[model samples]
Target: MDETHRDRDAEGRARNARPRDGLGRPLPYGTEGVGRQPEGVVRSPEETLREAQRLLDGGMPFHAHEVFEDAWKSGPEEDRELWRAMAQLAVGLTHAARGNAVGGARLLRRGAAVLEAYRARGPYGIGVGALIGWARELAGRVEPPETGAVARPAGRGRATGGVDAAAEAPRLRP
Candidate 1:
């Protein structure tokens, strides 16, 4: 047997080679080395939003936020504003994960404000639309107790429970 047949786990622990799939076989030749992209395709604003959503799904909110920042900076001015807002929201969530509720809420409000500023424009795009709703909801919730934290303004609770952040951001390449 060739050494190439050997397989190892992340820690280099040799284990039983289980069947690749339900069929009990290895992946096809052309697909063996294929990997998912950090960000997905971005043919348009909608697609880019979807990519950011994928990052969110994978629990890489900071990375997702970075992706959105790239998209926002490269996008047109009108589109940039909304993208930046969404990016900020992603960052806010990251802050929340670190127990910085005040900072999170602050970023969330800023993002919501950006979106609200453009609510009248045609199609805030799916990612931003959902984010706007989320930011608004987050704005209303009492800030989690943080040392030396100051209270921030409450968000206006608008209809719509808020978009699913996971579904809203997806990995995409533009």
Candidate 2:
């Protein structure tokens, strides 16, 4: 029997298998592995917003984007733009975290622009204007010069040299 296939739980799922490190080397047995599952379909707007906010607050912008994408895919037709814009904003933050300043700034501005149309009365009471303002400020911090270099703003606590993730992270309005 193959050693790699030796450990299995009652349900036949891998049990005592060692998780791999970034280099693909097997980690010590019992080492905890970090994993996040993308959120499933959420029909309620309130629930979607709440989950997205929780993810964003936890500094998991990519996960937040998944939640927003679900909303965009499953929400009412009239609210498609709203959900898409929110997802775009989350992706923008994700890109910034990954050190893609130009891409991040572009998505941020695009998301803000989409929300600007609903500034007077955003869906689900979202503060469109405030969100747009935040996006603009973050974009300013990530200004990509002609050389395509992204500027890292001070005080963001990120070692990747980009916008301050915590400082520039968007807050969803209740």
Candidate 3:
């Protein structure tokens, strides 16, 4: 075995043991990190909404993304679009937090488009129209700057648009 052994979950799948910041950014080994969402849990739409909202409220878009991802993967085919859209929005916020303006804006817009399809018949008491508006608003807010423009001033390092995840997150329930 090499000195730099890989981390593996109990099921023998590769998992990064490195700690992560609140936004899910990996930190150096031995640093303290927030709790990560476990992978592969099946959740009802309502449950997913509650849990994802809790995570989002705590400025943990990346973790909320995982929750939405599990919903996307595990949800019924009829509703996969909704869940996938939710996941995309969460990840879009994650990108923003990571200071990837282009990616953040793009994903935010994409998620809005995807979620828009559900406006008429969106399920689970979701405020589809409201959610769409929220996504679009965030997308517009995080839109990439003009050429040579910067989202943040220099020397600020990476901004926590991740924190914006909490400020701008949509309320799935009416």
Candidate 4:
């Protein structure tokens, strides 16, 4: 078989090897390509949170969703809800970035709902109350930007007048 044919098979295998991207999109093959993160490779909570924050701050919420997902899948069971909620938040941002206001609002509210129970104690030092408040506020404000508007300066995504402005990466509370 030719190298091209062999490469295609290898890519297919890699695509099935791990979790998909935020939108459930299948990642391309190879290290240089966009692929899912390796399974069973969990990181420290601090490390994962920090990395997710970095991705979000960089205007890459879709990538951040991947990190949060890993934490949800591999982190301690006790922390699963926290990670899942965080992942949902990231995906919500992803939807907003892609200009899907309704989907974004839905995910944002859903995530906040999961987070509500944890707000009293502030799990993992995360400001659960603040995050919940933020999510609810964001959900109310989400509205897709007008067509042909200028994107955000940092290449984060399209920025609408009200809710979109708040959609930028939220500061993770200590």
Candidate 5:
């Protein structure tokens, strides 16, 4: 693609014009794709959590990540880490569904740690502990196959290679 044809926002920053799948994977141009969350929208913490939960419940962790990303970038400094960790958790789930076991596990652990640490201090109405458990469960599932160790979903849900795992996703405000 030529520079002249690149997708550019009003600020002249380059953005991918390519449509993305439900998991946020870029698709070839001209191919119809799932609708994604809008970028840079400011919302209250409640609104962000609500919308992100909706996306996560609908098996769209990648989209949820974008919502959290918006919150992370636009929210008050004190809450930035909370949103950033949420985004990381969502992306970690995305990797798990994509079957990148090592990457997925790493991210899940990283996000879980952040959230857990934050929980000790303050996490508002968010169920930080439950969210940590959910991420940890998924992380255990994403362990390398050669390890002969994998955490089975205990009536929570199943992994379907990133297709749709709503049951396996966490309820953010439980």
Candidate 6:
């Protein structure tokens, strides 16, 4: 067998080895590990927030979802809702990437609702509010660019506004 074939088999084996969870035992993606944050480590919410934003901005919504999930797990249950909303938004984007616009919209709207609730609670309200708007905009298909141009694959690295990526995404009904 060729080295490429061996590599593919190894990858398949590794994927098969991962443990499953209640949700069909799907393996967690992106994160190296799961742990409750320990003592003596200074936490920077802004950094955590920024990292999530950066992943989303760079078009790696799956990774972004993982980052926000970590943040959610580390936070108090009350504050966790905000992070959960963020994580859900990332997941929505991932669904969008997979062409599931309807699934994405459902998740985004749910997250936005959670974010709005958090916003009314004060403290981290401002941050949650900002993201809520973003989620709403995404769910509603508001233009991502001011010029109404959403770059889409023209063939390879090239892209054009003629193709509506948002419109092309799959729409799933509840």
What lDDT tens digits, residue by residue, belong to model 5 across residues 1-174?
443578988899988888888788888888899897888999999899999989888888899999999999999998888899999998888877765556677778889998977776546588888889888888887665544466654332333354244666788876
Where does candidate 1 stray beyond 4 Å? 1-43, 122-124, 127-130, 145-174
TM-score of each: 0.55, 0.71, 0.85, 0.69, 0.83, 0.55
Model 2 alpha-carbon miss at residue 91, Å: 0.3
For model 1, how does the per-residue alpha-carbon lDDT over 1-174 read when each residue is reduced to its tens digit? 343666676789885343332111345433443132343334366666666666677655666676777777777776788778778878766655444556666787888888787666535345445557767676555245445455445552212333334443332222
Q: RMSD to the native, candidate 6? A: 12.0
lDDT, model 4, position 11: 40
CA-lDDT, candidates in order: 0.58, 0.73, 0.79, 0.70, 0.80, 0.54
- Best to worst by TM-score, what's the order? 3, 5, 2, 4, 1, 6
Q: Backbone clashes in each candidate structure, one number apiece?
A: 16, 1, 1, 0, 0, 3
Best model number under TM-score: 3
Q: Using lDDT as the measure, which candidate wins?
A: 5
lDDT of 3 by residue, 74-151 (tens): 888988888888888888888876777567777878888997788898788888888878777876776644665556
Error of 5 at 85 (Å): 0.6
Worst 10 residues of 5 by lDDT: 154-163
| Candidate 2: tens digits of C-alpha lDDT, residues 1-174 | 355566886789765556643212356666654344344576588888888777777667777788888889888899989999999998888777667777778888999999988899877878788899988888777755544365545433233465545556677893
Ranking by lDDT: 5, 3, 2, 4, 1, 6
Residue-level lDDT tens digits of model 6 in 43-158: 35666666655555555566666776777877767668877877787777666555555566678788888777667554432456666676777767722333436555432222
Model 4's number of clashes is 0
* lDDT score for candidate 4 against the true structure: 0.70
